[model samples]
Target: MADDLLLGIDVGTTNIKALVFTTGGALAASASVATPTERPHPGWAEHDPHTLWQAVVAVIRRALASIDDLRRVRGLAVASVGEAGVLVGAGGEPLTPIIAWYDQRSAPYAQRWKTHDDPLETFRATGMLAAPIFGIFKLQWLRDYEPEGYAAATTWLHVADYIAFRLCGARTTDYSLASRSMLFDLRARRWSESLIDRAGLRGDLLPELVVSGTRIGAVTPEAAAETGLAPGTVVGAGGHDHVCGALAANVRRAGDCLDSMGTAEAVFLPLDDIPLDERLFIANVSSWTHVTFGAHVARDRYYVMDGLFSSGAAVEWMRRLAAPGASFDEAAAEVETLAASAPPGSMGVLFLPHLAAGERGAFVGLTTSSGRAALARAVYEGLAFEWRHMLDTIEGMLGVRARTIRAIGGGTRLPVWLGIKAHVLGRPIQVLDMDESVALGAALLGGIAAGVYHSEDEAVNALQIRERTVAPDVALHALYERIYREAFLRLAPTLAPVHTALNDLEMI
Candidate 1:
């Protein structure tokens, strides 16, 4: 009875999720398991690739075990958090632990790139700013610090690509994932060989290129035995989790954007043109290959992305500190209650939530008058301010102002937080009904590759996009504008000395 089901395995930083859906576009079953991130040393965040692979297999098997019949699965693909990857040795095994984007071990490497002349050229080629969060910088870190591991590696692969290779013996990566590496040529739709050589990286380390939804291969017999997939179950190419999540949220066409709120908050707009807009590049927002390329796209279409990296993480941290041992739902309720009573300015406290490893968050303008509720409200407002800042920066780059933003993921569940974002950004937030849009997007891609849908457009049209609009309170807009300009905007620069000291002491 379950024979026509499609599967989506989302490998996220906090957890791994698997969703099974019928061809009729109804959810059948879903399961998830924690995927722990390990911090073995200062400024390093990583996960053993072998253990990650085992977790993936176990999660997939557990999800499939609940189905009435294992043969019901038609196809599946992996969606993963961007910018984390590992290298494979000659025998096609992991040579090193996967370095997470949150890891700052490569911070110095990114700093060194600042001395390059005409930085716009690198941005034009890769569509990425020179940051440690990019995969190239992480690669440089590994090569410089762990030369043995680098030498042992025969191929370097992003998270989704490695899972794809495991399931189907295909060593290929999609453009959407490749674009996050700062090594892919946006115009060429391939790896930048010149940049690779310049970085002293082996040209052969990269995977073969593939379009996002193409059928890489069927589940191998070995994979089938390990997991519960049928031997012939299709495996399709997938990309970054946010891009895939956007696909399900219908973030296409001009002026369309998706606000995906997970541990991080991602805001990206589907762009039809890939002009190396020096202005946009200089603004520092990233332009990347979209997950689903249109039929007419010839290496020239992309999505412009900007985000609040610690948006959800900030709130979560505050919740734990404010009320230890409380569930997220319980903490969220408390924050909402307090935020509703508190004014828009968070009572003069400006919390900077972008503290790096070993660095604790700072609350500026704190006085003896400050209480826990004010601290909680400050965290909420800080996240909203960052979101507003991202919108301003990305809007300037894209030259299109969004009147409506489609929101998805866990953050959408909190109405109070959504209201704060809506008020701060001064736009109507269309919060989607589904919390698992990332999983749904992955299944959509798998369905396309399996011939269940004629094309990406058809698959998107079939998605059940139930949502409610959260409109901004006109009065709060003026109040937030003042706070954003005077308090939130001034705090970062004012604390530059603290950040500098933290870095110098090697404590952050």
Candidate 2:
């Protein structure tokens, strides 16, 4: 039924949003609630699991009220930021708060990263970089720092799965979410017993794994009453936010890639094989299973991802600093226009946007001539240069040139920034018009589970989305390649010691 709606819930780090889409892929209604993250101590980020779940329920109720006929809504699915999962007790109540991925509380484990197993072998099994950003280390943090909570915990559920469990009483996670835990075996399509033992975790406490698009169950009467959803309305497991967003962006083949320009700008590539390239480590990239059990996009392909943790956040920072009186839309327009007026390379001034984690943003070669526009342009170019660096690493591994890069999120709205990214990558950048791609993706997966769509590909096609492709300017590309090779690429290494000093002094 065209009128039948699919509900997609996106539990992001900053906000929890619920969106409803028609079977024909039209967005019917939407509502959002801000998600307040707590930072009690330095380098710690936490969220109260029950508080977040209550916000999820509130958003759904608000979104359901957006339309007059709520009965038209059918299945529902949830997507959440990866790595931040909920630790629930034996009775399915939360035992500990969800740890934010950016939280550096687990950084101490990196010193003994290979304590239990070979690092390379662990990567081969989990396809996750040995970093504190993953869930496994967070679990270790709990066991070591909060022993009592660890002792009481029964199941560790990814943020999406925890919400799904509350909705339908199913403790299940999909392949995409499971892979981020650094416990799931990417190739074997199950939890890695050896890795689990090495991490001193029991497989029994892990949520049961399921393929994405599988109808796990339906919203329970308790969930329905709280959120105004119909009891027994179908629901399904969902994937990582970027993976689900890729589905809406039509990233389904080996050459397909997505540049999610959000709070953090992430680069995604579909791979046909488990990438064994050690250079990926050097480049800080990691591979993982697609939402489907096997390779993503196609049956034989997988996916790899890398990111800059400060993308849109940098823009927001600049907006507050350079254009405080301007509204967001006004500031964005000003930046776009300024980027056009200020030449490439930000007029010989380079900006490095390592703005998070107690690190300061740098603008070297700043002279009296530097202005707000120049700094803004430098920010755009700096992020674009980083994007090129990640893509270069992927290209080096694949030994093939990319044709186009698909981009999503609010960053796509800035034509100048998209143009800068296109020129830096030397490829066309295509941005889809799907306003709620992530939530729509979750809902589309719900549609598939409800038998509204036959498959993932069909679910994507049902949107019938056509995108605008930003073509690279040949001269601009050449100029960016030269500037990137000469200056921007060298800034990070040279500043590492400076960052270390700042951290040591508590001066950041």
Candidate 3:
């Protein structure tokens, strides 16, 4: 199996990674290095695309150093946090800093586009809701804010597409990444020229959309020399990190789902068709192409994503602010001990976990008696409850049931949170064996593109490995049911006024 080696690269919000995988479905060697992002102003996040490209080369070189038989590595793929932007010049140099998906400077700009006449028609055409994080608005914001830069822009590319351009000297994005941009018509499976025009951007700026796992090209000799990899190694189009992570968890069918608790908690599941429900707007049902076989067939197989947008992020904030010296484990441990001491409902003190900007769950009586411990427990409970609400909301829209949910990411490392999620959702949760499944999934796709696997299913079968399963506790389930009912009935409705007042205050 040393004869068949594949490399997968993941460029994420905070780090860049390269994983070397053996053809026999094992991680042979890996390397990771931090990618820098600058916060120039409040609510703005920017990364120098050149820095990321260099990090990618660095990790690949380090991984190659660890592998004795470098000649065996035949293919590579790059998975990244998908956001649309421009890569310019003769070699696709970025004209400006890459705007992150988390940047909210374009929020109000996106809001205006959302309220444009014929919003539903436009939405149906694009298969995505207009949002600041979706990249279409970012492009509009770019045109509006930096008209000079827009004119100078030569080629617009998604992060993965930009990385591919660096390695193979070509431009393209997989359907999954394209679908995230709100520029691609998910149903039509192409760039929506109408939407592009509406956003005041040129349609030609977008890269060609390919299905994941298709070889875009071989790594250029220059790229190989810089990265210490053999020239002409195949490079495949990879999907978004979240979708790749789901594939890493072995989520193939409709019922196979993953609850990834990163900074935010997202529930991803495969669906047989495009969910055409008005409630998708209310429930915030976002869809992406399957990592493989994403073509629409009278129906399309999609990955439906529902998330709180803020979960572990909230916990991280609390730990940083309140317990400056405490590690996450220590903070969580403190929360558990204190929560056990406190009453079931945090002593009538309700916390709305809208710590950042968005609110997903509810609240009740607010008293000063709610100490830090109660607030901590509330943050944890609120996140769990929000996931519960999202699960129900997604099911209502799909008109189908998810038999079980698998937990992945750093969150799964916490048995307590995993237990809380399972009890709150009333379902068994399985934890994937692999860490960095996103990179692994990307590697598997590259392997297929290089002809290491006969089919996508075979690739998945060879790659996925289950770690353990956590079943719901009946006693905890009953208690959580009572709490969820009270939280939904009295907590959610009561928080509307508080939320309004909080918005008025602008405390953050």
List lDDT for all candidates, in order. 0.79, 0.80, 0.72
Return the lDDT, model 3, position 297: 11
Give the CA lDDT, 0 to 100, for residue 105 in model 1. 84
Decreasing TM-score order of the candidates:
2, 1, 3
In the range 1-508, model 1's lDDT, one tens digit per residue, is 2258889889997899989877655788888888867989867889888788888888888888878877678778788988899999888888888998788888788778867534677877876667778888889888988799899888889998899889998888888888888888877787889888777788788899888778899999998898878898889988889888888787866678778998888777777876576765655534221111111111234787776677787877877886688887887887777777776677788887775433445788888878887887888788788777767767766578975689999988878788988888877899889888888888878888888777777888776667799999889988888889877777766777877787678743
TM-score, candidate number 2: 0.94
| TM-scores for every predicted model | 0.93, 0.94, 0.89
Misplaced by over 4 Å in model 3 are 277-300, 326-349, 356-372, 488-493, 496-508
For model 3, the run of ten residues with the poorest summed lDDT:
289-298
Error of 1 at 494 (Å): 2.5
Question: Taking the tens digit of each residue's C-alpha lDDT, what string does model 3 give over 184-259?
Answer: 7777788888888777787767777788888899988998889998888899888788777777677767877778
Per-residue alpha-carbon lDDT of candidate 2 for residues 318-424, written as tens digits (9 for 90 to 100): 77776679998887887787778897888798988877644566889899999888988998998898777777766765675566688888788888888888899
Clashing pairs for predicted structure model 3, backbone only? 88-93, 363-491
Off by over 4 Å in 2: 114-117, 277-301, 357-360
Candidate 3: count of backbone clashes, pairs at least 3 residues apart or interchain: 2
- Window of ten residues with lowest summed lDDT in model 2: 286-295
